[model samples]
Structure formats: structure tokens, C-alpha cells
Target: MIGHVGFTVVVIILKKEDTMRITGISSKPPLLFTPLFPTYFFPTHSDRKDENTWINIHYVEQIKPLKDKKCKVIFVDDQTITVNISAHSMHHQYLNGIYYYYMMDRAARVATFDPDSPIDYTKPQLNIYEALAKYSLFEHK
Candidate 1:
């Protein structure tokens, strides 16, 4: 049977090498827990699996702090869950989740390009000025 460390290793492997690279760049190495899906789930507490509470970044509507140093996370569907973490800490995790999501998205976009695809030479290429004019904010008469 695979132990905890073995399971974690498998997860890291499945997540790809980019996860480690991103963790290094962000200066926040995922310790005991890493996001199952970077864009979807993030742990409010990452130190221990027993204490960790995963939240869906997309569904989070608001985070409110309680008097006892905990946070209440409200979801888009009006569901709320109180986690034993400070509001500031929870917010930090939320922001980190967003950052990871964007990083993974950018990596995916870059990795999907087909270098061998033939470029259509018949289509005229637009210069910087023409491209800017075409997408300019100001309306043209």
C-alpha cells in the first residue's frame, strides 16, 4: 500500500514539473499539501493534513473573520464554512491560489503551440501601427 509520502510524490508527479518551478518562483513551497487542482482547490492551512481545509477559489464570494481568530468563507451559492485560520492567512491562500491558476494557465498555453505547423504566407501581416489602430480604444469615423 502507498503511504502518505508516496501519495504526495505521485500527486507532484501528476501535476508536472512546472509546479515545483512555480513554487520556487513564488517562494512558497507546498509542504504537506499541494492544490489538487491549482485553479479550483486551495488549502486554508497547509501545514498538516488533519488541520487543512480546502476551499474552491472560484466559488468563494467573501471571507470574514470571526472574533476567535477564525475565518468564515462564503461561497457563490450562499454556503458558508468556518475554518480555523485567520482571515489574513485565508486571504493570502486565496491570492496564492489565483496566482497558481494563472501560472498554470500560462504554462499550458505555451506548451500547446505546434512548432511544426506551417505558417500561411498568403495572409498579409499587419504592422504594429496597423494592429494598434485596429484594436485602438478610440472610435474611428
Candidate 2:
């Protein structure tokens, strides 16, 4: 399967280990949640604001299927990790069996994904899958 990734990341500082922080606003010293989604730092319309409010969506960079692998004996003496790999796609389980066409082709105007069960969907990886599955146009047989 081939697809493109859209990034909505919040560009922050460049620290050691090549790190990145999103557009969350900082509060306490040794900051708690900075530039994250649903931050009151921006205009947040919640259920408290109205009966039908737009849900705060957490944006992600991409759903990269990791096809890269490297193996090395960093530590010895029974410190071995036999990497059992599998070929798989991403997006939350809730988006199970959603075809790719319905997503990008039709511009995603009318579609709904049944959330993956046993899923908290508190994160992007989970949320995307459930959302994607609503449109089965790109599902695999």
C-alpha cells in the first residue's frame, strides 16, 4: 500500500537526541504540557461552550510504516533481542479495513470509521485507525 503523510507538527527547540516539541503553551516551571493539542492557549470550543462543538483533534506528523531495521550486539551475556517483525499499516484500529481511496480520493466529505474496540484512542495512532476504518473504500481483501 502506498500513501502520503501530512504533517501538522508544532516546531519547537532542537535539543540533544534530536528532539521536538509541538505548539503547546508552557505553564509551570519544568513545564507540564507545552504546545499540545486542546490547549487553552488557542481558541478552544468545548462542549461547555456549545452543544455541538468541534472536537479537539490531535494532529500528527505521519503514519510511517517502519521498514528499516538494524541489528547489533550492544550488550552481551544473554542480552539479545531477536526482533520478530511484521508488515503492517498504521492508523488506529478504529479505522479497521478503511480503504485508501475514500480517504484521499473523495476528499473525505462523507465517511465515518467505527472506532477500534479495546481502544482508548487517547492518542493519534489509535484515533487515526478508527477514523480511517469508517471508509472501507481502501480496505484490503
Q: Report the C-alpha lDDT of model 1 over 1-91, residue by residue, as the tens digit.
A: 8999999767654443344455442323232133222244567664345777667678899999997889899999999999988899888
Where in model 2 is the C-alpha error above 4 Å? 1-57, 68-89, 92-141
TM-scores for every predicted model: 0.59, 0.14
Per-residue CA lDDT of model 2 for 36-115, tens digit only, reads 22221111122134321111112222233334532211122334322212112123211221222122323222342322
Q: Model-by-model lDDT, in order?
A: 0.57, 0.24
Q: Candidate 2 at 124: error in angstroms?
A: 26
RMSD of each: 13.4, 20.0
lDDT of 2: 0.24
- lDDT value, residue 29 of candidate 2: 8
- Which candidate has the top score in lDDT? 1
